[model samples]
Target: MGDILVDRQEMKKKVEKFKANGPSEPLDNIELKNPFPVMLKEDMMKMADAHKQQHHNFVQKLKSRSNERLEIPLKQNSKIDSNFDELANMSLDSDDFKKVSGCYHINIDAKLHEELCSKFYLKKSPPMSVTKYLERVNRLLCPSTASLLTAAYFLFNTVFNLKPSNMTCVVPLEAPPEDEGEIQMSPVNSRNIFRLILGCLRLSLKLIEDKNYKQRYYCKVVGMQNMPEMLRLELAEMFMLDSHLFINQYVLTRFIFQFKVFDHNVRLLFASMK
Candidate 1:
């Protein structure tokens, strides 16, 4: 009996030892051939660069498709006045540029404007530029309209992958003055409406082409308390929240901005028709 008890105690000890070091069942039949090693620094950098390139390419494709569907048509329409294209060009060197100087900060030049507009409708003769027109138009549009356009333009230019920019504590100019945390705009002249609208259009194409412009510029409008109610609402609708829907936000926003800016001016030119 003493021997049997001793043997039983030895057997219990062996079982406990086995339980302590028992192999866990393999996960989903994935037997480890070799354990995953820590990633090297070089390998990690390569992975990061690869991810950034892939992200840029994906955004380019998205912006391209949108541009094709929307801006391309207006560009092709023969009925639209060809002079507007020239006017776009003239704004660069002509005294007319001075008329809209209030809207354009000194940083943007006439040459840059020409470069921006020509991307959509590769025009010859005086070289029509969108950037120049935007500078002028923003000044011409109502103050409220200009404010909205400028804000929209900056937003369109800077965002990565249909994502809104990580805009921080520069309180939007539109915020209530009574609010303790609000930010205010400095005393400056220039219409934001045309800027925003044209900026959206320019950005849409730039994003598609993956050009240097989109890479360099990315500033949203700060304060926009005086934006026209109708224009503001329309622009907000155009800036899309979802990528899965029917139309591309970039293309749609550009079109809406252009129409809103030009439709009135064109109407005035032919106001007699009414």
Candidate 2:
């Protein structure tokens, strides 16, 4: 029993020494199998060749189309000279100018000439009253509150540098009367005027805000406090209608100009009263 125990201790020591030293022989029998499949070199070359052939064909097609496009203009140019004689014989009359007063006048009849002149040369009717215009604009715009039209007008004028001459006080008729001698009234419609004013206001606001435009001059116009009480109330109402208008400094600046114009008119009215 003592000799058997001594043999077991010797065997344990040998196992410990083998573990400490690691394996002495090479692991030739442990074959390593790759988890991923390897692509053959010839197959890779074949794929590259196919891709190149497709690319070459695409390039050839592009060149052929480009050549055809270039040749089209050249083919069309040859036919242009042949049509010149036909074009020369055609008379080009001015749609706007009915009569050309030259050495020989156009052979149009006197009645026809008079009709053309009346149709083209008649002046448009004058714009409606301010109150009526505002009422119409409010109806069309459907503003959150009243007096937005008044605010829009002053803001538009200041921002866009509007002039009396440029202002379309009257709206043009959509269709002319069938009778040549009938009088046409071109009273300004609220819809047309409001659309124009709104468009200009939106465009100007966008430009001023986006480009960081200097608005100190316009700001002064809006900041005036000497406006009439009625006008001030209207402006306050406009602000209440859309708080978002105050978000942009440019829009806010324009908004203030409403008071300036009203203040000027009020001053004039008081002076006239005196």
Candidate 3:
């Protein structure tokens, strides 16, 4: 019992001594050894350079591939003649005519305009429905009557280096209300209208050429199956409008000149029309 008391007293003394000393060093002052080896600054710089070089090489390879893919081959006379022959032989049936005349109820299914905008890299949002876009296009193209004024504007800009300002005046017309029967007028600019026309054209092309079954069906239902034919008809109509209005002397001339720069197939089609 005496020995136990002595040992307890000794333990107490040691505990009191430890209490007096507190910690050997402050927690923040204590040094810790890392398990992993520390990398040298030189080594880190070398690694960074290697990574940058790798990225540059990867970018170069992608650019090369892109260039190769976008390269167009020079066409021979035989191919051009064949394309012209095909265009000459082409004929629209009764059903095709009906489709072109807007007799068919064409519905835009599955938010196709969004998909097309994404594909074309167009940042603009599409109208609520494809029909609405079509209506806007028809209004712009025809105006009071079937006319080629818009076509002439684009052609003149592209071919004759004429600015859009020279072609059309920017009239502040009220936009159609989102809901039917709303007579609110929002001031729309001509440049925006031009962008809308371009967007509609690109959207129509995307719909007609989309590989997906549903999108293709929607395009077919809307009489957009023959995009080339539709464009040709519009151009022809524009020529008729030009004859009547005599708006610009170089309208058709610019179109013909610009048409010559197109691919042989497209050139052949237009040539056959002549």
Candidate 4:
């Protein structure tokens, strides 16, 4: 009995020793399968670039849609057009954040030309006139009605005081030369009215749009050789206009009426609305 007990103890001890040692191969030396695929640095960069492109495309789509909504506001909603109080009291976003098709397309016409000359101080007639340059601008930016109207407002305000009832826009003084070394700027005669109007339009586009176009591009469009001078004019306009740019639907509607735009309803709205 004693010998059998001692043999059993020795057998248990051997089993314990074997369990502690594990297998003959070390765990570090054993090869293990990977569950995930390994990606190289180049592959990772390409994936990142693809994501960036997708994001850029999404942003561009948003801007395009926004501009489309804002352009060509020549039409009216019969349901809303009659109610002056409602239109006036309506929220800022009532017309989709001031992007009214009412803010919609602006076309150059005889009526616009008459207003520019009689109201604003444009002396020259078409072909080489401010109106002709505006026609070119229409091709370039496709400015919304709101943008064009707001720009007109800006330019009109520049050379006229609001207090006067029958005031016409005055001709601006000659702008300083692009080269600071030059003694003085050239005369801003009747011929240079186009430049003033173009600057105003550029500023208006900047305010109404997605703020994507650069001043450098505006300089290119105006055939202004000096970028610095262009920027100076932008600032100068801002200063003259008292830095007020954002326009409301009410004011915009009034502007349309002031310009005698659209049909009898516009004339009616002008006559009726406060």
lDDT of 3 by residue, 78-153 (tens): 1323322333333544443322222111112223423322232224544445457557545533322113333433
Q: Per-residue lDDT of 175-211 in model 1, one digit per residue for the tens?
A: 1224233222221113333333443544334334333
Supply the global lDDT for candidate 4: 0.51
What stretches of model 2 exceed 4 Å from their correct place? 1-122, 145-250
User: Candidate 2, residue 110: CA error in Å?
Assistant: 41
User: Which TM-score value belongs to model 4?
Assistant: 0.41
TM-score winner between candidates 2 and 4 = 4
Candidate 1: stretches off by over 4 Å: 1-190, 217-270
Stretches > 4 Å off in candidate 4: 1-127, 163-189, 261-274
CA RMSD for every model?
23.2, 33.1, 26.4, 23.9
Query: On residues 149-223, what C-alpha lDDT tens digit does candidate 2 reach at each position?
Result: 334643433222221211111111121223323322222243333323333333334433343423442233222
Output the number of the lDDT-best candidate: 4
Task: Write down the TM-score of every candidate.
Answer: 0.19, 0.21, 0.19, 0.41
Predicted structure 1: lDDT: 0.37
True-vs-predicted CA distance for residue 6, candidate 1, Å: 99
Clashes of each: 16, 3, 0, 11
Candidate 1 vs candidate 4, TM-score winner: 4
